[model samples]
Target chain A: MRIADAGDPLMGQLVARYGAEEALAQVREGRLGPGFVAEIAARRGKPIDCERRLAAWRARLPYVDAEADLARGEELGARLVVPGDVEWPTQLDDLHHERPLGLWLHGSADLRFACLRSVSIVGSRAATPYGVHVAAELAAGLSEAGWTIVSGGAYGIDAAAHRGALAGVAETIAVLACGTDVAYPAGNHGLFEGMRARGLLVSECPPGVRPTRIRFLVRNRLIAALTRGTVVVEAAIRSGALSTAGHAVKLSRHVAAVPGPVTSGNSIGCHRLIRRAEAVCVTTTHEVIELMAAIGDDLSPEPRAPVLPRDRLDAESRSILEAVPSRSGAGPATIAVSAGVDLMTTLSHLGVLAAAGYVERTDHGWRLRRST
Target chain B: MRIADAGDPLMGQLVARYGAEEALAQVREGRLGPGFVAEIAARRGKPIDCERRLAAWRARLPYVDAEADLARGEELGARLVVPGDVEWPTQLDDLHHERPLGLWLHGSADLRFACLRSVSIVGSRAATPYGVHVAAELAAGLSEAGWTIVSGGAYGIDAAAHRGALAGVAETIAVLACGTDVAYPAGNHGLFEGMRARGLLVSECPPGVRPTRIRFLVRNRLIAALTRGTVVVEAAIRSGALSTAGHAVKLSRHVAAVPGPVTSGNSIGCHRLIRRAEAVCVTTTHEVIELMAAIGDDLSPEPRAPVLPRDRLDAESRSILEAVPSRSGAGPATIAVSAGVDLMTTLSHLGVLAAAGYVERTDHGWRLRRST
Candidate 1:
């Protein structure tokens, strides 16, 4: 069966099985199989089999002609990498329930390689001159320090990051929430084209798809996942750029924010982030590089340091320690319940463990020391 | 001898014995004795103390008419208070080397009472709207919290601080560099008059002494010495307000600064201070209050907490700790020499001490823990 025809049967089956939103989620997560369409159709009260639906859906497939679009992308010296492609970035998998169906990419460097050292630089679309200058300086510095710059292909801070990265030898990538072939803002057409040539332009949707607010929101995760860190240069309390920072932090990436004057409304979000300790305050290029160095590889699978020393720990202490995630550093009470231990024993064990350097108290709670 | 004549003879002899500047310094430090006139005449250089020269100098005594000035000050309901007066603020003793001769005071509040919880609010004469707003808000809040606002009687931030404090129940104090009867700017005549009526207008110079640039520079120390803390709201890199902050720091008073956008020249000095760790960044009245509470009484003679613990330290560690000031943290080599131990031993001791919680490693260096 043709690819589009094959996809249609699964689409309807998926819709029937999990409803529209769930079906879309399944497709985005690449979980929809060949029989998915049939199952969806059955669930939707449509008793059509996959083959019959395939023929009808094939008529609508012209709007999503991946083969023809690939040819056009090839002509532009770009490539369309799907979810299973070797060049596809696995970090993007962090989106889990909101993963993209495919990615349209244009660049010399593989998307996977870029994602390894990438950091998203985002801020206000209506940036002040100070914001723009800081953004450009940060982008240039990070790019020169071997970080791949990731940003939205929009005006203001995003465009400045792309421009700054282009000034450096390292590559930059612009991830659009819109179609690969379309630059949504139009004003950033030049910057988008430059990114396509010297860096990369990526999009989740197929060619000719229009941009939507929901798409933009969903797209933030992709940027976050494709980076080891995210730096918010300037943002108002409600700026959309903060969404990217949230996603980065959620994905366990380093989040750094630049502080501006307390009087500047544009810096309110950055200040709040720093104040709440959600993000570290960084002022210089070197500090950003240092934070990135400290975070290191995001894909490394090594288990985090233990919250307590295993050798010195007693049964109760061991049980409590085992109950807490090594990285989370949960409190004694949480660990006690998780370990099925009594609270008094847990507290005594914790105190002794802490005194013996077997565990450390963190801002959150008690945590095992990695070293004895 | 009449009070004027006696005082004049003493003043002339003081100028001859100690030189004008040194005599002023002595007077300011309250080191001059009751027999100050006779002592000055006795110590006067013979070359300049000829009988004829002594008569000539004594002839100039009528020109040193502070009592006449006191009479005029009384006419304005402003009292002249000397250093030994019961109502003198003991905190002014902090200006060991740069003390003021005497203070010309106006208003109903006792000078000592007004200085009890005083905090100087100073900044650039050219204040931004944001700066002015923040200064006014801080002044009003601090005044409401029972902090006597002290500031130079200048335009912009200073004027705003005075006005804000005056609007609250607590009276503010204006520490003029000029005479109490003299309004330097002339344009602030109404403000000066109001200050004399409700708030206190204080100056080091007796009546009829014209305001001079050098005197203003010297006067900043009085403001610093009289207050328990100093808040710099907004200042350019070279602002005179920074001089007050410097004096406050030197006097070991709590120095707080408001942070502004790095791009704003007006905030550069405050930011620099925060970055240097010389001043804590305070955003609100509550923060200032908390800082003051943390600082405690300024007049207390007891030393504050020892920056590092000594008894629990090893010989090497003790040497290193001794080398470092109690307030400032220590580095390795300095600790090594002070402990009379080799560098390697010092390092090892430091490692052990750090592990045992006898010392804490900070961003700058290792600091001795105040308690075991």
Candidate 2:
């Protein structure tokens, strides 16, 4: 519990290379371990102040209580999922040294299974009505397609996404920066409770930890890492949602952004991402699914013009149809002459065109079908 | 005037390969020797319909009068621009066999020069207000940046683009399906007059020719070929604007599409174009310029987060700044240990940080600068 620091890459590396227990024991005893020190220096890209780091760690030792932290989590009905736990999402290992030491999960849904086919939808906390509408619609559609929707637990776009997903068939997950038991926003307390009942509330922080500004930035990496791809519904040019997209880019996951009116300042970040080729411009839920699903498993069909009855005719038939009188009618001989085709060719095509509803037999001869 | 067909690929190729005079004599005499016949077959991708095609041309000969047509054009203040004319846009030659044999221009602006840095803005006649607003904004910006705007003189997006460009310093051209001297829509007569006074009106049709549905389809190619790129402002699923984009793509001209609310039916074709990778997603006029201008010459600067005072600090200085109290204050010795840096290093960085508006010295120690 004392060694879980997502922002401290050097500590994460030490815990990853050496066992968490050994790394903690070394920190506790203030021993001069050459191997651990060298590893830390390499990760830091410079020589580290081992003595100072150890001193800092020792200072926090008095407050560390692994058993008590677990008990506190149990009291809140949340469970701890370590690196090798069955419910642990292995995709997060893609973060390597930056991965959380463990995750605190509070909900009925299994974290690993729920995240197997998940996509993150994140955007501005002060989104416009257009942004909120797009986020919710996208989430609902994705959720109904049997893919879980993941998001932050804040208001605006995140809250809309969570609520939309809840309305669908699949479960939703919100990865918060605060502890699973603590709803930092307080305004989202009901949302958090609803998630706990039906979906999942996940965090790396221990039971009683409160979120800070830095924690939110660090938490963005987890949101990017746990999903197959991340979709930015709406964001300003400097929004924190962009940081999550940056993480997705670094992780080599697909990144997609929903476009809105250029007049909307909230859509600037999305348009910029698209302009820079950092993200794909996604308009509909089917397009999002196409990005998240396997190559050929969920391909979006090409958009096409609605087919007209005359569109089914061959080139010669079309020329003949055009020659047919719109007002009255024309005989095959006159139509053939006007169409520059032989009478026999015109006669045969007229029969086919008539059968296809492009032409009809009138008392005089042949004419274009009224609707066609 | 007899040889001014835009739809006849074989005729265009013949006029291009052999000079117009020679091609005309061959067609007029009904003696298209083997060479001309083979050329026509090659362009048509099949055996030539020599007898029938010749019959059709021979039939129209009685109605053509080259001298009288020129006199009529002179009366209307319209000039004919053939392939070798100095005012002709050679970019149209990229269409090869599909290129127009000649263009009729009726305006003060130079056809070739105005088209030198032009972009076509086209979309649905049924565009929503959002599309019109974006189109005008983009056009005005590009025009102010010294780009000529080209579009059909239609009711919606096209009119907006032309009007916006007219509002800027650069000239705007409208490529019409009908005669340059004739306003097909009638309602756009005033717009055509304004264009003739400041910009230009161009067409392949003769002085008094009227437009048909097929002529509009054929005219889209000219719009695409005349510019550095084409931007689709708004379009329904089967809109004519998409055909213009298609022509732009085939001509290797840059193609961009402005995005609108996904709920808008008029934006469906534009989103489809983006989704299909047929068009780049463009929001601002600067992004459109980035696509049209040579690489690195008119590049749009990458969007960035607003700079903060502490953002300039090096890692050590940032740590020192973080250690400084926000609400209260802390002494150098206390901050050094808290930040895991030596007292001297902390003191040196605190001085640099204070000078940069990040921190301020106080009786107790140092504190973060207000608003910094």
Top DockQ model: 2
* Local error of candidate 2 at residue A143 (angstroms): 0.8
DockQ of all candidates, in order?
0.04, 0.43
Q: Per-residue CA lDDT of candidate 1, range A206-311, in tens?
A: 6665665556776888888888889998888777789999998898989988877666778877866764567876666766776777555322232122353354
Residue A6 miss distance in model 2 (angstroms): 2.3
Model 1, retained fraction of real contacts?
A: 0.09
Q: In candidate 1, what are the lDDT values of residues B61-176, reduced to their tens digit?
A: 43455557778778866776756788888777666434544577877678898888888999999999888998999899888878889999888889889888887778788888
For model 2, residues B293-327, the per-residue Cα lDDT tens digits are 98888987666678875566676676667668887
lDDT accuracy of residue A139 in candidate 2: 92
Residue-level lDDT of model 2, residues A134-179, one tens digit each, is 8999999998999898899988999999988988888899998888
Candidate 2 regions exceeding 4 Å error are A42-45, A314-372, B1-4, B42-45, B313-372
Write down the TM-score of every candidate: 0.54, 0.90
Model 1, C-alpha of B150: deviation from truth (Å) = 2.0
Span of 10 residues, lowest total lDDT, candidate 2 chain A: A1-10
